[model samples]
Target: MERIEIENLAVQIRAARLEDAGIITRHRYPGEMGEHLAVYEDWLPTVFIGGVYLGWLAQSDGRVIGGAGLLLINWQPSRTDPHPLRGRVVNVFVEPDFRGRGVARSLMQTALAEARRLGLSTLNLGTSEQGRPLYASLGFQAAATEMWLKIKTEHGLSGDSPASNRIP
Candidate 1:
């Protein structure tokens, strides 16, 4: 069967392969610290190779135009989901030129389908305000009081911060 997005655009939303690691990484363009990428960039290929992290890629005209990643997480049990695990949709991105063309949406839909195939009862994501409406339209609600605490030794975090290396 053929996969297409946007009537005549010939976009294909397909499983990203190990060979696509570089292209996917380029699209993600991680944070300033780059620690997440540094620790897990190679691991992307490893997990995909191991069938642990399934990545979705959107391609058009022989170029990667968008992408997203899905991973199973062992989150605490919730009333809505008694299961010990949930799915995480992360690193969603689309080329600037491809915005408003449904490339990101296509990638997300693919990820959701994969999650259902994996029998995940719930899914979650962290998103910017710009992307909120699209995600909300797809049934993603903001997590309750989701918070972030980046404990870096250089950032005045207590010596007991998780990032601290020297043992007390």
Candidate 2:
């Protein structure tokens, strides 16, 4: 593998191209390596379509070590507040070999800074059991238990789907 200088890492972080999807996806889903290539084929275009920001790739010796990204979410109004809109952090991943090396921390810090720069008042994310401690150390709290309910339709739900049915 080609050794990537830390200085080059910074430069690549700024100039990441869509063609780098393979590296990012592999880093994001390590255990499911068999599915990595396919997963990116399906999800990458949507990320671009949705305009989400994929974080920098951690490279060492020209190999991808980790990846991260943010998912923007709108907050809904609560009884106490008239406005409800917020951003969410998502898709944080670090390769096993790179764990504990501060790659994930650096990615997250960059993401949080970007979120703040975007003027988001609050950021939220759901975490796997393995990721909980890292998130907590970064000041993320478990506000509630998260659950997913999927409804399948031949043509998928229409725009008329009830607003309350979606996660906020």
Candidate 3:
């Protein structure tokens, strides 16, 4: 991994690999401070293995301090571009000790570069209140309408194949 100095802090930023999946998963905080929450259930390298997801890791002193992921979403063709390529930046995190030192900024820059290289027409991300300022400064606009659906295994979802008894 090549090292880059940020704000006088020597940091190494490298492409994330399959072996780093656990590191990325473990580093995720998933919510506000003191939330004690994580996205453990979805912490799999399948996406990374599938090649649609590209990620980067920021390391210092032989340990990973931060990371970011870019996921390419396949959507229906639009009018302007029959096959519009869209990328979503996710899992942007920096260790508490490494915050405010440009680690996240560097990672975000790297992700953007990769997105451009991949010919992505649009990039999107959902930011927490704390990260809003940074993202806004980087030119990410707010989405006017966003909707989500969470499938609860105990209720709408079932432990076996989403209640369909078969995996889709």
Candidate 4:
């Protein structure tokens, strides 16, 4: 893709179809990440057909420049949301050359709009440090209450003991 200023580029956003699975997968994993990760392409069609996963693509001159997806995940109803389903924004990526051209922002906005149309009040996403500002600008606050721990049962354990690494 040619390096073009945002104003000079005319990007079009479109709904993703099941056939775009390959395109979306490339954008989502991109390069070596796909090789190291476990990706199940077979299940992608079901997500689209089932209407549980919504995706959008950004294109310029008929070439895809970016894409994003929202997974409608089932969760136990909580006091604040009282709903069994919520939205999880995923795979927001823009080509290196297309960075800073508002492609990612456009894709996200479309996903959010779809979520709203489906009456989803709560949304979540995991982002890199670089994506923090854009998400923040879009009113995504730091979910400070959330934490993660990756367990490796096959490898047993390594590094500091879990007890020794306690927050306290």
lDDT of each: 0.74, 0.62, 0.75, 0.78
- Among residues 3 or more apart in sequence or in different chains, the pairs in candidate 3 whose N, CA or C atoms overlap within 3 Å are none
Please give the ranking of all candidate structures by lDDT, highest first, separated by commas: 4, 3, 1, 2
Cand. 1 TM to true fold:
0.78
Q: TM-scores, in order shown?
A: 0.78, 0.67, 0.79, 0.81
**Candidate 4 residue lDDT tens string, 63-105:** 8889899999997788899888999998899999989868788
- Pairs with steric clashes in candidate 4: none
Cα lDDT of model 1 by residue, 38-83, tens digit: 4456768777866777788888887878889987778888888788
Question: Which sequence of candidate numbers ranks them by TM-score, best first?
Answer: 4, 3, 1, 2
CA deviation > 4 Å runs, candidate 2: 1-16, 33-40, 75-85, 145-147, 152-168
Please name the candidate that would achieve the greatest TM-score relative to the true structure: 4
Which scores higher on lDDT, 2 or 4? Answer: 4
How many residue pairs collide in each prediction?
Answer: 0, 5, 0, 0
Please report the TM-score between candidate 4 and the true structure: 0.81
Q: Which parts of model 3 have CA positions greater than 4 angstroms off?
A: 30-43, 80-82, 151-168
lDDT of 4: 0.78
The parts of candidate 4 lying over 4 Å away from their true place are 1-6, 33-38, 153-168
67 in model 3: Cα distance from truth in Å? 0.4
Among these predicted structures, which one has the highest lDDT? 4
Report the poorest 10 consecutive residues by lDDT, candidate 3: 159-168
